[model samples]
Target: MGFSRRVGPPIVSAAVATLVLTNFAMVLLAERASHDGHLFASIWPIALTSTVAVVLVMSFLFRSIVEMGAELERREAEAQHQALHDQLTGLANRALLEDRLEQALCRYRRSGEQLALLILDLDRFKQVNDTLGHTAGDDMVRIVAERLRALLRDSDTVARIGGDEFAIIQARPRGEADVRSLCERIIETVGEPYRLGEREARVGVSIGAVFAGPDIATATDLLRKADITMYRAKAAGRHCFRIFTEAMDADVQRRDQIETILRAELAAGGGPELHFQPVIGGDGKIASVEGLMRWDQAVVGPIAPAEIVPVAEECGLIEQLGYNLVRQACALARRFPDLSISINLSPVQFRTMDFPAVLRRLVEGEGVPCSQLELEVTEQLFIDHGPLCEPALQALREAGFRICLDDFGTGYSSLSCLRRFPVDKVKLDHSFVDLAARDQSIALIRAAVTLGHAMNMEVIAEGISCEAEEQIALEAGCDGLQGHLYARAMPADQLQAWLAEAGKARISDAA
Candidate 1:
């Protein structure tokens, strides 16, 4: 049997005692034979032979036990090593990295040496995983980990903290310059191309760095600061590095406050109002009004849709916000029998299979005609979540709702999209409207309008801010127009008055 440290000494002592007792017994037998005159020579030879046999057996048994114990220790050491390291890349994991970070912080506190943490996230990694197989993705991750280890100093620690996020700890750096140089090196190294099976793949990393300072007191704080800084680097543009700053913290705080206020507003049913902008038809009459979401906070006055809508989408409030806007639009449509209302739908709202059914129920409950309700979708919905979204969109279309492809000319495959989906209307993006005076731009706009009409779809020109642009759109054969030139989006009550005033102006001009 293999013996542990605590039991080995006792077992050895017992074996030695047993061997001594056997020798003593053999001596006693020889002595007794000599005293009884039974021939001492014969007895002495027999006793020696028996003692030799016992010694040989004990030696083999002890050797076997020692070998068994050594094998057990070897297996245990291997298990411990595997626990601390990543199995695929042989790099330290988050647990081991955190432990080392804690140690480094302690050393810094005692010696006042500089320590830095870098958090790296690979850009567009999901695209690689989605396009290539996950096996290739795993291979790519392993290659990245190897490259990171090769680039860093032996004193530094590198770890894979998430699927696409890696972290590094610099135990001792010369100064901020040295840390920055190291970060730049890491970016360059990780940005290199890799071979995955028969194809070559490319990716870049965004890094966030933070040095040990008075503000940082724990590993969690260090990591959080680094992550925030990394996001800033990502925002600035990928394939870059950013050092942590106090201003970044302030920005994060402001964002959190905005989200909190938005949530509170949504919960209290006082979130925002839907303002309608009228879409003028070819004959110069209001055909429909697009519902635009507006929010004016007590602290931040008016928050633009460009700013607040993204925040809502990020915080998972887009679905609820979308539903509320649809409800309000339905109510407005009921009030205005002559005009249809268009509501923009976020891509995030179509993640669930029941979205179509839920929207249908909401419209039916509001007693709004299906023909008077239009849902505007951006091109990104088809590009990003095509499979999950197509069915929902089809269901909505089959239920008698009009689906308009918004921002039509902005995407690369605008023409292809019209052929792929069953669309009722196409809203020309503002870019074309802004650049309509250019010959090439006009040609493109004219082509888009012609194609849209040929496809049996209505083409609406958006962002007609001036008379020049308005004339250009009308000349380009656009069927409808919507922009600041006519009127900015206003509350339902304000829109009613504007419409009445516009009607009076038209009547006077005719007379």
Candidate 2:
């Protein structure tokens, strides 16, 4: 490769001709033709050396450029690979899966075929991380991903879209049965124990499956459907899956409407309608009133107490609702100046820190006497007896706040509760008072009153109706009673009018 010619002399014709010219120049200058042969040969050698050097440098430069380009390409490829995949499980990430799903959706849309999306989330994963440590949890996640991959076909895509969250796109699922079958397989696969290091861990999955076709408009809608189904799967029980249904959508809509209204009510200074159920004394005196809260929306008819109360507790609105109701009742009492008002407090309120201080502040600010304000707590409000409840009750009682057990005999340790709590009165649950005349019921009522008297607490029997029940409660040592027998829940104006009537009756008797 260095030379492709046969050299006949010191140089080829071009180099020799250059030498001949140099020699002729010497002759023409009247110099001897014997001019130095060494110098002539040297001229040809220098030119040849220059050509070879240039070629060698260019060859080295070309090799360096090739190696540099290859190194850059490798880095870019590695980054691209990492971006599309999960680092821990080596599974495709949500982004890549979404892209692929969009492609498949487009194909299905054109072909008019059925496609399915399944999203699965681990149940109580936080518990696993808390009890077993994150290392074990991580290993379990990897094991789950691997097992899920094993259950799927090559055409299907399984991705770890989030932490302890996995998703699958089953292209052309046969039907609901196919989707259910895959769900079962996934559950069983993940349900198996994972051995990571010395720890054996177990976790369950809740899966939501959506069946749709070209009619599916958006990937967002598909995700929402799957997520809602996943929650349903959770509500049903873990380690299971549910198909998307219209009923579920309605349930979700109902919940959303409730949430929106609740937020609005709390923000807009309360649209809550307060109803007062009369708590009449044994002798028909207007004893006091129990405040009940009801909500009726423009779209949602009369909201049930069962629905609102639990939802409020779950959303941490119970504290606000309870406080607001208490404040409202206090304001109403200021109007009468003598009427006592009772506000029902849920267990959630008793457990909240600073609740007592907050309640006291509201009462004192409204100029409502603790005697005129009765704090009605349920039978089991003191469970666990956390400091939050302990000081609140004692402090309220010390401030002359009347404490009453709202639903007696409904929880364990009912007898002990009368003795233990700083309650001033015990309200026999409606169930017992509703039929107190019966043998067993009458005995229980009598026994409850005896217990209340022994604990030095007043007994207020609720749900009284007949004259017989009223006489029985009076004999049982119950100091007060409530029900339709004496008075029913009425409007504020009606209650005031009744109070005025009772006042006149008392004055006429004195005369």
Candidate 3:
């Protein structure tokens, strides 16, 4: 409407000039016909002057109208583009990407050229922002977009669809080189670190690609396939791209179903409940049991805890799960005087501000020695912030809780890391214990023991099954053992019976 009004003045001026020009042309012709006298001379001069003025006005008016319209059209186009694009990156938004994708699919059916889309998410963007404020984060996004744009051809399109998410669409990528080259270029470009205010921040892109020529009919199907591949790319350890596959989609669907069930179970009062795995004493007695949360769906038999526990963590239900599990474990931790029950800590829990105080209150309120209650945490936790892991561990330690490094060999564990991290016990990964000797498992165990002894931490062997495995672990300098052969994980209600059996066996052995 604004443009329509702005154009009105130019159109009217053009029309007026055209009318005046026609009148002047007639006057000039009439003057040419008149021969002599003052009237002829005066009329001819006036007509000549009028004719020149009319021609000049008409030419100027015509040019102005054309120029205004073109400028208006260009302005409108730019405005529309800005509305659908991310401001910082000038990439099409999620909404525009989906709309254009549907159109692309329709066009692909008419001409059998391939249409492919790659979804890219910036890895560690949150970490960068958290460590170095939002200003640096914004600069990183701009830098990444510039690098990504350099990798693309004029025919291809790249869009910023999320905070750190980007979408690239190739209208007709028939050649293998076209597709591979584009992906490779993007990978190389995004892998470079952008020097944002002297931080040398590196932003890696994880891309999930999908191809739909004439085969795919539905937009949802195409997007779902791409999304599944993106999840696979993220899971396969980030900083790379993965092409979509049928199996990946199936795995995604299965996981979605599992997530649905897990949420349902949580809604229905957190299903099947928890069990405890006993951590034996230095003298081979029922010491403390580590709490293990399990799930048994009505339709599925005994769902593995590892699967749903992560789902809980991903869905922000981890805090709730942790609180509930810790409460239950603490309640039981109160019962056994000679025993100290341990709880597994999630990485999210370690980042919470009030976690340490909450833990302190739980231990103090229950009159349990915090040292008796060991916290089993994975080695991967150290990859994050020093400040984040600090308050939680320190508060627990100060409150007399002993922290154990759970799953020792599974993550970025070095000799230096072992010494630097404050820990009371080291639980050798069950992988090494399961094999024992064939695969240098004993050597690794010995090294871990040496490291633990050097650091003054108690060494515990996880899943020590046979007599030979237990003896091997002992000789490797393990202080305690746990496995199916020792005793299976049991509910708190059954802990009394297990304790009685363990106590009787201990008495008999002593005799």
Q: Model 1 scores what on Cα lDDT?
A: 0.85
TM-scores of all predicted structures? 0.80, 0.70, 0.77
- Counting only residues 3 or more apart in sequence or on different chains, how many pairs clash (N, Cα, C under 3 Å) in candidate 1? 0
Error of 2 at 422 (Å): 6.7
Task: Write model 3 residue lDDT over 100-176, tens digit each, in one string.
Answer: 88888878787765789888888899989999999999888888888877777787778887789888888788665
CA lDDT, every model vs. true structure: 0.85, 0.77, 0.76
lDDT (10s digit) by residue, model 1, range 222-281: 889999999999999899999998999887887788889889988998787899998888
Distance (Å) between predicted and true CA of 396, model 2?
4.8
lDDT value, candidate 2, whole model: 0.77
Off by over 4 Å in 1: 1-76, 109-111, 124-135, 174-180, 196-200, 231-242, 299-301, 434-441, 503-511
Better of 1 and 2 by lDDT: 1
* Better candidate by TM-score, 1 or 2: 1
Tell me the spans in candidate 3 whose CA falls farther than 4 Å from its real position.
1-71, 85-96, 124-153, 175-178, 192-203, 213-224, 363-372, 432-447, 450-456, 506-511
Q: What ordering of candidates by TM-score runs from best to worst?
A: 1, 3, 2
